[model samples]
Target: MPRARSSGSPNLACRSATTNCIRCLPQVEWEAPMADFLKLRDRMVDIHLARRGIRDSRVLQAMRTVPRERFVREGLEDFAYEDSALPIEEEQTISQPYIVAAMAEAAEIQSDDRVLEVGAGSGYAAAVLGQLAGEVFAIERHTALGKLARERIAALGYDNVDIRVGDGTRGLADQAPFDAILVAAGGPDVPAALKQQLAVGGHLVIPVGDPGDQKLCKVTRITESRFEEENLGAVMFVPLIGEQGWQEDGRRAASNHLPGASKSQSLPEMIADAAEDLPGFDDPAFGRLFDRFAGRRVVLLGEASHGTGEFYRARAAITRHLITHHNFTIVAVEADWPDAATIDRYVRHRPHRAGTDKPFQRFPTWMWRNTDIQELIHWMRDHNDMVDDMEARAGFYGLDIYNMSGSIGAVLDYLDRVDPDAAKVARERYGCLTPWQSNPATYGRAALSRGYAECEKAVIDQCRDLLRKRLDYAKDDGDAFLDAAQNARLIASAERYYRIMYYGGAESWNLRDTHMFETLQNLLDARGPDAKAIVWAHNSHIGDARVTDMGAARDELNIGQLCRETFGSDAALIGFGTHTGTVAAATDWDGDMQVKRVNPSRADSYERQFHDSGKSRFLLDLSPERHDALRRRLAEPRLERFIGVIYRPDTELQSHYSQAILPEQFDAFVWFDRTQAVTPLGPEHHRGVPETYPFGE
Candidate 1:
């Protein structure tokens, strides 16, 4: 459920590594109190716990009662019930639902009993304990995290659960003799203090072994001087840290214990069996691609990097074929609306609004300002020119929310034309953003760090005003009305977005992707219910994050996974990859553009598997049409590279690579053995970039 963790509730039973780790989970989403979440929670309990042999009725009830999403990272509440653990603050993780259930059951808490949970984490386990026991005491090593856990618990009204910050390995000595003690993190050995703190006849359950490797063990204090230990099962966890556990091991801060791909499976061979040799860009054999996605109304075409020429050319080619023969009318992208609208105007044969900035004028403009993109824009313009009806012509649109200032202007321009009085009111409302128009990020920082007022209400009001006048505006020009309303909505979204980047929640890689997803929805609806669309975005946005670290580990969601839920069989995803390449990118945010050399694919990566398959350029279909054996072979998560507008060769592995199961991450994989950089407008030389860049930004 990677928010396969934007998930509903837990099968939280056996999050593990290997066939072992909580990999390849079936993900779900949340809804009303008596809606999707309750049904999903029951399904999770039945399928991932009870069916797996958890027989404790109390434990099962506790699992079902606690709202795991409340304890999860923000924007990732959707993933609260996934089988896999989700990342939290302090580099810690909320234990997967299965692992928590298993440990809690082993602890054997009873009503009227006092329970202590070592390493409280997100307070998920403690909240569950509060359900079974009369009182629950939770200790966390990280003070800030403990405070957050306390807040989450209190907010959920778990008054029986009390949390504090301290060295948990030492246990709560003054409050000794707890009926049950559950240690969430893995330690080198059982802490003597914890065993001593347990009441006679009580249970102490802890994971014991080397870091990232452990077995859930239940120890029973049978008498004053005797104890019995029993092994539960193999499990993995972050290192237990304290005087009695692993000491200050920063390297173990890694969230997921999922390891590198095992060579035993012979994956490269399996991919070879299903690979389709693709023809060059100009070849008519693109008919193969048409067949692959012929039944799908919306197909997403993704790139390994934003600056690769081959990816751009190929997507442009496939997009061309789709629009020409498959009735595809929309080509949505991972770009800002205000910028893409200029290109949209070009493709739709409408005149670009005077004084509007040309497409991709912002930094890393190379992403859309390249010769390859220009080729597509020119072609789309020509193609639309040949069409009889404007509605039937292919149109380009952007689905990102970063163009705050531009959108404000677009909204104002529209209101001025249709209703001058509303335009004056809009200017007054949008005036709240005047100071930060040059740099919206500073506005968020100022709001958080300097008590600057947020413009959320103003922008939201403007958006509503525009929407309230939708009919009048639409009658003037429905298309323009759609554009204006969307921009207003984007402004409202971006205002909150910029402010929350410094605050907390209402955030994430999720907000941007959510905005993008919603924009796509608006585009499809504006076109019609039966419209066919093609999406062009980075692999991180188009490939299902549920099958990637972005979802399973990072507690993030993307447009790709959203489309899967929204459209099911109606949407298809295809991701591109490269073995080695030269790409145009910036070293840091807003840094100078540079043509960097992309390193060879990591040995454990999906790109490497494709490179080894001996096909320079080919397509591997992983759709339902493929054999189950092939799907099984590629199900194990492996490293996949994602190059954005920024690239860093030295930190490539950590910065660019993310864990992903190829078959589930995408409906198909497109591989290029070697590639070259996109030719940025007015540039043919190398330049120094920035020092640090955001991952997948």
Candidate 2:
């Protein structure tokens, strides 16, 4: 618990006093004054840190002593003490109080220990550490942020703490052999330099792994040659940028796979050497590897991340080629049916349907609403316009099962236009779900808690009724009837999907993939049996999950697995990967979107294997007929990365990589050494913070 400082005492300075000065005084005795802030700090420690298992007394005291408000931006002072990372200068953030406390505690700071902190964003963590240690040396990569942090630390009267502007990865060599070190950002692994700088018996705390997912590890220097490590659980942080770490320009430093110059090429080296060069996507001749999958009925194109520009552009180029040369008619994506239907109509050159102009409007709108996708959509429409055969025009569709309420609305809208009696029946049936309109998971939980009788029955009844009148509805409008029938089916499936997702296990994963595969089949059936379709989805969803450790652990299967099962020789999966660059992602679910810098791919991962190849862009054909060393190397299991619409570069490793047998997962692969984020339509379209009730500060 924290106690108030004595107001106007020699040890304490009052805001209303003669001078506007703030300082932390070292005093043994003080009279109580301004109890409000003192109580608030104590309360924060009690509820946010202590209750959460942060038991270090020194960390608690330092947290209580530091005025968190003084370190934050002017307007954001009110939120400073809250248990969340607040934005600071240069887009850097002052880490949450609990996190700072946890890291400080993990470091096991002694009263006389000399500490070094990498990435001293706002000097907040250094200040806290300074209270526990005798001296603290903090380094920040951004000059402006470092300067500001220095000024703030000086103002707080931390004479022993030093703030320097330089690359944090390259620890201060001149002041080597520090008693303890704390890295505030994530890295692929512990930087060799930082490890060497730790004194014997000293401790080092760092968040290690990819940017999106990381584990807080505590390393103790056992000897000059050995260090013991312990994982302190998962954490998220910015990238550690420097010569020995992620490059500032977002490109990974050239891989050192060629160490010992005389050594022969490794497996990754062989794969890279054999890869075919790929010109820019804008070139008419891009994606020459598609020539190998010429006769494939289903070509599933996968992206490492949703917002990588090269992934989108390359996929679009391949899709365009398939559409023009191979007569591929349908383009199915991993999205909701109702949302993608809007794009379907637009691409088919059909009259712009009311409310169907804009396609994606979900939490991660940037995934499908970016400039690259917009350009692809326009190309589809232009291509459709030039086609003479109506059946030859490519039609877009979504295969995911995430839209229960939206599909219900679409079904009713179709029914209202086609049959008023059917519409009334649907309204009554779907009325049971209207309460949980915003969240289907809540509906599923409620239904599972008591009973699922009425809701399940109603949705099933609605679907059956819609299907029963399909012929009659088609007599007037075939496309409208088909759309309505699909929507009805989607409602029933979505109910089951949501129910299974809440309950947990492989059932939900299987159910969603099964629905997507079934939907693809339905599209082929409707397209007169000669239909060829292309799929666009994350590599996790598009790659054969059976060949990966992720799928084996979860007993999960994805669309790629189903495609291989059904189409066999006729299906081709092409997966894409990138080494590093910028990405558009949110900090948390529904949090404001930011253009985060992507840390380079892990050296042990497949992306590094590609990066080492030295090609900016390349494609590898994995067909057995090629009989190359690359194909043989790719067949071996290796850690592969995958990023979805929600990317947390700070904690990437835990969120992204999985052991994958590359050759078994995909028939072909696309590699980009570096990539850029997809540009959003506007700031308003970026992620927005979720709504939550605020507790008074």
Candidate 3:
């Protein structure tokens, strides 16, 4: 056996006077001032690293010296010296101490070796490498993680360690011929670029296999024309997410295809096999729907169309589970900020306007002012009433920028409460947009006609002013301040969105979604680190546009792609789809709503394939952890139908259908073989009109 640490020893707890993780730990000096930390670090090196066959003194010494606690998130500092891997931002984890020491040992670094570390992660491994190598170049795929790692490394005064954000699969070229390289993420294969960059007698260590499981392999450059590969051992890691590596979830697997259909399955066949049939929405078993969203920070619930009742009901149910069980604090929807503010107040138990027109008075009013939403808010209010802590109660927010005039009024109302002086300045700045606030699009048209926009600087300044006073104003009333600040932000983004809309398509769309994403981020921040949010939006806005024509053909970005890049596995996107159903939509933007019969999905569309699955309702888990073959099969390009507020069925294919790789679009797929229109809340809705076809494609 190894050594047994005494359960009551203080030296066992207190590191040496000159030891590691002292900032967070209780300093109980036995022989010396920092003996507890010292003993702890030494014990970790001996028990975790050395006992695991990490024999190299350099690796052991580096592990012994580096302060691992500095690498972990604030709350996790207490467990910094533990053997297991620790959680970090972006849903990625710092490697286990033993693994870090082993990888460093395998790299066989010389004192003056120029080492390159891929997937820098928490910068813990890089800091260890800095102790062994003269220079360290680290690459992290995510910009935020890399920046954080850089800051950490800099704080440690490790001037030799350089961390940059980029595709690590390509390696660093200009500063090539590294003596050693380590790739922390598992890739499909050892990247060819990394192999080429390895100097003769150099070694490149990487995990090669599926995203979840892999063999830690090392490539040693033998000569100019040859390299040798040795399997170190089996390991698991997050996929190396980038070009020249494993693609994001729902991306195609390199293998599995159809020749004679003997060894392979077609798209519909695969979907049928993988689809998990769901019970009735009211069934107790339906609570298990939250299983797919377990551990997620932001769960985006998508709708095939704005008026689908099943989509509304399903999302409301799932969100309820998340709130009651998981403490989800925010329900952000794709509606204007001012309109949502009223619902937010009602659900949060704030005073509501008694005699006012219900929200979503716009042409697509039924989308939000539906029975489904009414039920959800009523439950939310009940839940809020039961909670003793105000912060613990869930709140609703809107993430759209269509109501510029309303947003301006909200900002003014908020300013009138806290700081009238700043409000006065804001009014003066916002006054310029007063004439055109009612019709922002018209203002945009005029801006386009004049070749210059009015109130651009003024709106931007107003937004900045609110943000500048945020800290001070928040003390007076945090919720009220958030409302005003977000309204101001919506005004700013809306001003630009309306202006650039005439410049053409993608810019306006991108700005709108970006604003939505920012609103979600702000809500989460205000709610604190533990807050979770469920976003309700159209499929087109939440699906990963990068894998669809929205990005490929038109160069646009949506909240799904943004969340995926930022939150990685922590953000779950579930897209809803239907085959043939009755939908609530309009022929023109402001046209009256009609219950139209939706045609069966086109033969080539994924919706059609789901319908062919012979399951009335089911959930498709598109997470990488699911069947690899199924994802690869569905990864093939197929048409996806998107019916927005205005569904023009006369030109169905041209107006609604767009090609996308379904697997790459969402984390999960919720399919209703046939869905129906939402129950509009007011009696004035559902006017019996002439037989209107569904899916105004």
Candidate 4:
């Protein structure tokens, strides 16, 4: 007979970070599950929960112990550990890990507390809560999902959990006075039954408002007939179907309309009324926007898309003001390091070899190799020439870490010039990667497979050797040595990043952003304590992820999150957006550049509201002192469009729009009602740019 499995689940049994904890089951019974599942669960707890501020220890332990794969469909077990939501039976889904963690952390579960869970699709969240509380009662609306959840819970040995099938909107009255309640679906408003069932001092966390758009609200029972509500942030969920919620058909009565849609004035009228608050982009009065952030050490500039001309021009204009008036020192962007270094050499008048003059030649080249960016480079060069002190000159650099091959070459070339012996060792270690230089993904696929050796050790050893010999090389050429060392670090990080990407999980995304943030920090430290810098990247990178679904669903963080964590009030983040326009993008990866037409803003989006304002262009300050009406409009969650270097108009909504709490994500926002694509410097650029609006409306 096979040895009995551990009485306690893996989560409760392992107190350490590693998945090497001994199992009670026989070797074969344990190897299959513990090999992949236990290791992934441990990583999920460390990276997704601990690093993201998910504090409650009980919540973390429960999350780590639960076998998420058992709760998902068999074929999708590979994706069970991911932070994203996955489909379950009866057209339901298991809540994303971060979302569940957020709700659990918000509930502040006590050791002896009883919990109530609404819309328990897969019973995954219930199992997690069971670990934190004394008992958990989960209600599901779909009969099949309820039955499946019960079976999963029993099979997983969660004896503290109980499953029931009913309209979760009404809650479980028979088991009243729950210490905490978590609703997995969105409702028009907080359900009365759920509120009444909560004991004093208990919390009810639910997504409240429209189904496709909602606010995560936490309601606390203060006393008899007294309760408090706090808007946690924006969220999106399917409708809660039942009495006192959405109708069985998912429609509301005529008297009850979507949130913000029942106002007496039409959308156009509301925009016209707020016209006084809209300031022209070119207005001299608008200069005060950056003026308020005068003493900030870092200012992050964000663009909705990579190829919007207005975004590039606007950020450049602001950057110029900062350099000339505020004494800002550097401009770092989301491009390859070597490519931006070429621009840095040009601006500082350093000699550059002929072949290295043009730096950007990759996919989405228009992002940096365009006329708009060309003008900025020229201006920086002229400005630097006027400055006598080298330290005072504004410099350009790149913070992204996607150029592994280029970085490897840069490191080798530097070592070859300074220390031939070190170069030989470097070449030997890097040789392990040379075979897959053109496409790192090929190596990643192999490394992630069974029995395939990883080059991680070799790359790390090479980085260590370069750092050990840094002083020797620095004596000859300090800047070159510094560049070489940074490249070595980038290569090691990128090698691991590519491998993680092959797993199709959040680790790779997190690694890339973390690398960029570290690069920015290094640049700042190298510039001295008094230096200031401005960052240019997509809104998705510059906007705080904690307030968006990106964070909740994917456990992803970006440069903006790092800045906020590191600099706090010392950093300012500003975002840009547009309603409709032409954008320079490609149909596919490495495809031909095209000036594609951006779809008009959807009806439920913030862009639609801005477009209706009848202003061609404007800036809306998001500070607390702004007009209450303007703040109110932006405070509510709404659809926000995000276009990258690639665009597909047909799948715009599915691919781009995300529900976002505008005021919470950025300090200020700039909007252009109508815009056009950036003009590429080369002749081949306009092959996709049409000559007229609608090609002549």
The root-mean-square deviation over C-alpha atoms between each candidate and the true structure, in angstroms, is 13.5, 14.8, 20.8, 10.2
Q: Please give the TM-score that candidate 3 achieves against the real structure.
A: 0.61
lDDT of 3 by residue, 1-697 (tens): 1122222212111111111221211222222224455666787787656754679998899999998878987666555665656678987888778778888888899999999999999899999999999999999988899999999999989999999889888889999989999999887778878888999999988987653235689899999879999987656567787766766773523432123533234456678888888887777566576676868999999988888899999998888888988889899998888888877877787665443334677657788878788778878988999998889989888998888988898898888778889889989998777877766667776677864475889889888988987799989888888988999999899889878755543677788889999999999999999999999988888889888766764567889899999999899988999998898876644568899888888654778778877889999889896888878667755667887765656445545666678888998999999899998776443345212201011
Question: Candidate 1: where is the Cα deviation over 4 Å?
Answer: 1-265, 449-454, 504-506, 683-697
C-alpha local distance difference test of each model: 0.77, 0.75, 0.78, 0.76
At residue 276, give the lDDT of candidate 4.
34
TM-score for each predicted model, relative to the true structure:
0.63, 0.61, 0.61, 0.64
Cα deviation of 491 in candidate 4 (Å)?
0.7
Error of 3 at 421 (Å): 2.4
Candidate 2 lDDT over 281-320, as tens digits, reads: 7776785557778799999999887778888888999998
TM-score of 1: 0.63
lDDT of 1 by residue, 357-390 (tens): 6567777678887778877887898899999899
lDDT score of residue 106 within candidate 2? 85
lDDT of 1 at 680: 79
lDDT of 2 at 5: 45
lDDT of candidate 3 at residue 13, scale 0 to 100: 11
Task: Evaluate model 2: give its lDDT.
Answer: 0.75
lDDT of 4 by residue, 352-413 (tens): 63445257776667888887887788788889899998878998988877677888988888
lDDT of 2 at 184: 87
Question: Candidate 2 vs candidate 4: which has greater lDDT?
Answer: 4
